[model samples]
Target: MKTIGRIKTNILSMGCFAVLLSFSSGCGKDDAEDTVENCFGGNWAERYAAELEVYANAVSVYNETPTPANCASYKTAAKNYLDALRSIVDCVPTISRAEINASINEAKAEVDREGCD
Candidate 1:
């Protein structure tokens, strides 16, 4: 009888430990982006991807039907989008922030040089 009782207690303790472990493992994974270690987390990638799509669409539209005014507008929009990416400089890692800044500067120069040719 004593052996059976000890076995049951041990089983209950193991079950409780398993539940706690499961909960803890899931806790940080769900909020990974919000955690301090991740900083801007996944937002930088998402924002950059979205901005690229917008810039591509603008360029495509301008290319399909070129006009000086439309080209300038498209360039301006793309520049603005690229510039906004710099806002996450402090949030992202150092290497990424430098790369983003360089990209923005390079794109701005390209936009300035592009014309309705």
Candidate 2:
């Protein structure tokens, strides 16, 4: 669950846009002018990965307390994840799902450290 926390912290600090741009700009996947848009999509995916990881953990966490706010955060995180997914899908060019999945898994340990449950 630390991975959830790590990513969440990164998003909260670095913001949703930062994650998207981090990869796009570094990946060298597009023209400089389109970098902004491409980064937007990429970072959104990153945030989605992090956000979902948290929400998924929250599902089990809420099994313990289940407060209204906690439940709502869970939903908001899940929805943000999904919305980010939709954005990736709607991107002009597709991204590598396998790579993204791998990256998310790499952060699993950190997400676990967040103490979700």
Candidate 3:
């Protein structure tokens, strides 16, 4: 009977420890900031900057080539740029949507000026 009581106590202790461990480990809260910042996860501004770089590179290529294929690449990159802005607006509602849209408009103007579209 004493051995059985000891086993029950051990089981209860293990269960409590498991619960404590989960709470301390932030279970179910992993990457929670992903939603708060942007849909792609991790530093939103960095991702935005990287996408902008890609668009800039595509724009540069379009400027040199101006072929349909090059223009298509530019358009695709422009779409990605717009998508990132939208995602930022969606994920971080506290941010100014107008500012995000302004950036998008500026990028679109750049694309148009480059004749990429």
Q: Give a tens-digit lDDT track for model 2, residues 1-117.
A: 334444655434323433454545443445454433565434445535666577667656654566765655654664455445444433323465554444444444344344434
Considering every candidate listed, which one attains the maximal lDDT? 3
Task: Tell me the lDDT of model 2 at 85.
Answer: 46
> Between 1 and 2, whose lDDT is larger?
1
Superposed model 2: Cα runs more than 4 Å off: 1-28, 31-47, 92-117
Candidate 2 TM-score, true structure as reference? 0.40
Worst 10 residues of 2 by lDDT: 10-19
Tens-place lDDT digits, model 3, residues 3-105:
3233223323333333343244322334556563334453445445666678668767866777878887866776676665555554333344565556556
Give the alpha-carbon lDDT of every model.
Answer: 0.50, 0.48, 0.52
8-115 per-residue lDDT for model 1 (tens digits):
233233333333433433223245445434533434444345555675566667766677766766676666566545544455445555665665576566556555
- What's the candidate order when arranged by decreasing lDDT? 3, 1, 2
Show model 3 residue runs off by greater than 4 Å: 1-33, 37-42, 91-95, 102-117
Q: Which ten residues in a row have the lowest lDDT in candidate 3?
A: 1-10
TM-score head-to-head 1 vs 3, winner: 1
Better of 1 and 3 by lDDT: 3
Tell me which of candidates 1 and 2 scores higher on TM-score. Answer: 1
Winner by TM-score: 1
